[model samples]
Target: MPLVSPDNSATSSDEIMRYPFDTMRTVAATILSNVSIALSEHEIAWKKAQDYVQSLPDPLQPAFMDVLNKHQQRIRDSYKWQEDFAGALFNAIDTVSNTDSNISTSFQKIDNAKFTGFGHGHLIVADE
Candidate 1:
């Protein structure tokens, strides 16, 4: 898959600041895509191996199949781990993005808030 380039001409400063988050999200998605492709390839190879093992003479078939099955399970487990890791990475990026957005919104609110002085007691109140 091709990575998409950001269109800077139409992007605001806020969007520019968020570029890193976008990049991270894209990278995480790409990692997941790669892991899926690898899993597909592994599955194809596994089927071929199984077919080959099954074609072996009766006495040898069981032993070879046993080994293949064990190794296949391990390989599948490894791929599952990779897929899980990628998913976690994507979630982390989303969390960070949300946090950043919240922070930015908070700052904007603070910047726009109007503080007013109350009567002789010298109390202050924010005028929303």
Candidate 2:
């Protein structure tokens, strides 16, 4: 099956195909934004936890600090994964968008050529 039909109905079909990608891109961007906010909150909480551990007596602080450090590392790792995921999602969106644009442009050129004889010596004019 062709990516787009010669008729203009393909315009709507193109839009239909583009909808999901656009929606996914929007959702991914929103999720990434929320993740950033959550990461900031995590930093604040981690700092608070560290402060609380430091308030403990010197003998009690070391163990609590160690635990906090381990948990912070885990949180950082999780955030890194999320950042990587967002990067991947954005890349995919960009690739799809470029492909979609190229397809649309090609289809438009084909449509124009139908009326202009594809730049051959013979020209076909369309009736308005």
Candidate 3:
């Protein structure tokens, strides 16, 4: 899998001083967006999943949004259990299902997003 810290609390706030809640919210939103894309893409190119996913990177990504951006890059790389895709896919599924919440969302937030499946409002919104 990707190099995840065992704690998984986003412990590394290397740049958290400059970017606060906004960074977190943006990262959360982008990750959710990608999961949606990957889920849809999964059905579209189930057979060529590897090719379809590895191509996600090489696109310009902001530095503050490091989590989503790097996570995407990792998804494109190959691993025996297809760790990258599998990790993203599993996280997406878990967040959706609330199974083992690394990121948790409430129904009120879902209502806030108008149930549109975007901008769930569970993330911190700060930074530049």
Provide C-alpha RMSD values for all models, in order.
Answer: 7.6, 7.9, 21.6
Write model 2 residue lDDT over 1-128, tens digit each, in one string: 11333455644644343336666677778878878998999989988988888888999999888887988899888888887887788888788878889999978876766373434665565544
Q: List the candidate 1 regions with Cα displacement exceeding 4 Å.
A: 1-19, 114-128
Estimate TM-scores for all models: 0.66, 0.63, 0.24
lDDT of 3: 0.47
Clashes of 2: 0
Q: Write the per-residue lDDT of candidate 3 for residues 44-127, one digit (tens) a residue.
A: 554454444455564622332455445545654423234355456555644544533323344445435533232555544332
Tens-digit per-residue lDDT, 1-128, candidate 1: 22345766655544334336677677778878888999999989989998888888999998998888999899888888878887887888778768888999988977787758667886465866
To one decimal, what is the Cα RMSD in angstroms of model 2 from the true structure?
7.9
- Rank all candidate structures by their lDDT, best first, as comma-separated numbers: 1, 2, 3
Q: lDDT for each of the candidates?
A: 0.78, 0.76, 0.47
- Residue pairs with backbone atoms closer than 3 Å in model 2 (clashes): none
Which ten contiguous residues of candidate 2 have the minimum total lDDT?
1-10
Number of the top lDDT candidate:
1
